[model samples]
Target chain A: MKDRPLILVTNDDGITAPGLRALIEVMNELGDVFVVAPDSPQSGTGHAITSNATIYCTAITIDEGDQIEYSSSGTPVDCVKLAVNEILNRKPDICVSGINHGSNSSINVIYSGTMSAAVEAGIEGIPAIGFSLLDYDWEANFEATKKYVKKITQKVLDHGLPEGVVLNVNFPKLKEKDIKGIRICRQAKAYWEEDFDKRTNPNGKQYYWLSGKFVNKDKGQDTDEWALANGYVSLVPVMFDLTAHHAIQKLNSLGFNEK
Target chain B: MKDRPLILVTNDDGITAPGLRALIEVMNELGDVFVVAPDSPQSGTGHAITSNATIYCTAITIDEGDQIEYSSSGTPVDCVKLAVNEILNRKPDICVSGINHGSNSSINVIYSGTMSAAVEAGIEGIPAIGFSLLDYDWEANFEATKKYVKKITQKVLDHGLPEGVVLNVNFPKLKEKDIKGIRICRQAKAYWEEDFDKRTNPNGKQYYWLSGKFVNKDKGQDTDEWALANGYVSLVPVMFDLTAHHAIQKLNSLGFNEK
Candidate 1:
């Protein structure tokens, strides 16, 4: 285990984002880091890939760093695919995404490009983790997140993740000392209650601004939303297999075969 | 159940696509249909929503049909959100997406806008199903898929879907007489073996076109890929909860709280 591990780092907030830079700095200390991320912000793009068009990626240095980096004209998921299929000579020991500029707790994970990038890596049999800070500001302090990031990344590299699983980790916006310990939890049953602000355009056409309120309906203590709200970093193990195995029997009983 | 059911219909291949129109026709026989679909093809958009910009939607009639329709300048998931939040006066009994022009069985589901629309509807507590045929042509014949689509949809309407679950149905590209009966199966373990075609642009920059071959590594006959290949309509009960519940205990054993 003395050999240095190969690490792939990426984020949904684009290559030049402070959140990604913070992630790169933390990962640089642990292993050889290669960054393949979007050229522009792609926050809620989910698991989207660039299938309808061609993607352009450029090799460039963003700062005084040892990490090899590429800026992709594609989504976060596309970046991961491109990294694994086009850029890297070998599969990395671990893939880490984000240290994102906002929260991806509970239902928010469904619409997150950060988690999607990690999930993409996981689908390709790589141990992966997606990290998010509970702050949306571009200049939000990532100082308190560094140690935890290092700890979790080290633990995952030491002990590979279970089959078909990836980690969705979120940090509460607290100072290093003030933050509570990390908690292993499930995703809470929460949703964004949307409120579409409708308006008319100069061309007399109708348009809408999709805004929503985050509504956490679950009262369970063993959930990510509860952990994050209580100032702990929440880690939820997520998978790509979306099968509802328990419901299969009931669906089978409906007897579609019956005349 | 004597009152006519309200059915919300949509697709990733745009509102006027032949596949979407076929779905609408089949749905029309069972209930009052309302269409809210993308204005253009949105394949591979996954669970993306319109978060970074304004979305424009307009009411239009694509055919001499009884269904009311709207085309939105957003992704497939956005069409669902728009339909439920702004377009429909009351919640539809069921939401159906696609009869998509390509196969969305196994690993393809992760990157499919067709499944994403259905998954979005499931999240909103609406019973939903996404249908696809194993053909990618714009003029693919959907005649053999109609009977199965009708039966599955009718069954769903009669027996409500379990909470957090939706259905993914795929038919083989066979003649009506050659198709076998429908089979209930799990999603197959599969992935795309990506082959990125690198090219030099006129500006002397390199670009890549994402292409891949569908690789089904699993030999299990109880999987969707197997069922589809065997000339059957495959139905897999899909869920919105991404939590890997089995990995929770393993993750908890990490003891991140130890002093």
Candidate 2:
């Protein structure tokens, strides 16, 4: 690693979000931080990129900080792409996304814009991490998360992540003193049971709001859901290669390859 | 399976797209088809949901077919969710997305709206497949794709997909007579070498268009890239579990679990 590493910062909660501001503060203590994030909130925009629209990234100053920042007219993934390919003259030593207001544990990772940024960075061969808290309120306290966030980032910087892998770090809604140490975990077999909020407008037009209750069926203690429930900050090693390697042989036996 | 199976059809290219119409035509032959697709083109919208926007799905008739259709003001993933939860009264026998006007063979799966719908269906515990052709033209002939599409769908109907797995099938741009049979394959280690088209607007401001060249370095014949290049249909079984199972032990040994 360089004497002073270049750190790329981003979040789905937009550039002016309090969560991102808190992230920038801690990242400043670690390295030369440069934030390239979305101009507007982009929650649930998983792995999306701006191909149809013209991308515009402009330099912005939200607060007094040592870190430089740019707001882009795109999704969280687009910010990461812009950071890696256009904004940063050289490759960053590490990329960190979100001190997110909501949890991205278990099945929520598939719908998370925060983790999508981290995944995009990993796809570009950079060590990356996505951090989130259990609380979903805009006024949620971030004081406790900073301590462990710094610790986890330092640990990753000290020991580089594995090839094609990134970390999805999620915290329980607890005080710093109440929080347990970092715990390595797996993504639990969990899902959202959708119950859309169906409503009719004044014009008699029907619309729906996507709402769901998270259902965790896995009873394994070695999962992110369990760790967070037990007051420990869960760290799941995430990979982008979506191939179900175990099923390949079974598929071969199904006779598609033959004739 | 039911004698007349209830099939859920969807695509990222919108309800008016010829690719989707082609998909509906094939699905109608196999079962009772229901299409819930985007109202506009949503090519690069990978796994995105419409949580931030008011989702509107209105019943519409696109063409003459023994199928029902709904045009949704949402992304591809949202279409699948709506189909599974609200639009369809019962569980679908299988969810099929696309006859997409472009390739979703390798790394493009991460950015593909077509594959995202299939992945969403798989997440919802439905057997699903995404079909795409190598050609990018809007009016690309899907005539060559229908025969193999029917055969593969019938095969999948006969033998269901493994739990938590979905198929990503891509066809080479070829005539029906010139096309080869299906080849079960793995996702290739391929990526886009991004080169942004930096430009200046009439207002003297700078903007960028995200453009990139597809780069494939993997020489393995068992991969999707190799199969497509060799005039065969590539079918890669994809999973949504982002866990890097192999790296869990490595991360443990690196001592994140240690106090």
Say which candidate scores most in lDDT: 1
How high is the TM-score of chain A in each model? 0.98, 0.98
Q: After superposition, how far is residue A230 of candidate 1 from its true place, in Å?
A: 1.0
lDDT of 1 by residue, A1-259 (tens): 3398999999999999999999999999999999999999999999999988989999989999889999999999999989999999899999999989999999888899999999999999999999999999999999999999999999999999999999999999999998899999999999887889899989898899988889888999999999988989999999998878888788788897665
Encode model 1's per-residue lDDT on B1-259: one tens digit a residue: 3388999999899998999999998998999998999999999999999888999889989988788899999899999999998889889999999989999999788889999999999988999999999999999999989988998999999998999999999989999889888888899989888889999989898999999888889999889999988988889999878999999999989877666
Residue-pair clashes per candidate: 0, 0
Candidate 2 Cα outliers beyond 4 Å, as residue runs: A257-259, B257-259
Q: List runs of model 1 lying over 4 Å from the truth.
A: none
lDDT at A92, model 2: 91
Per-residue error at B210 for model 2, in Å? Answer: 0.8
iRMS per model in Å: 0.8, 1.1
**Model 2, docking class:** medium
In Å, residue A235's CA in model 1 sits off its true spot by 0.3
TM-score per prediction, in order, is 0.98, 0.98
Candidate that would win on TM-score: 1
lDDT of 2 by residue, A169-240 (tens): 999999989988888999999999899999999999999999988999999999999999999999999998
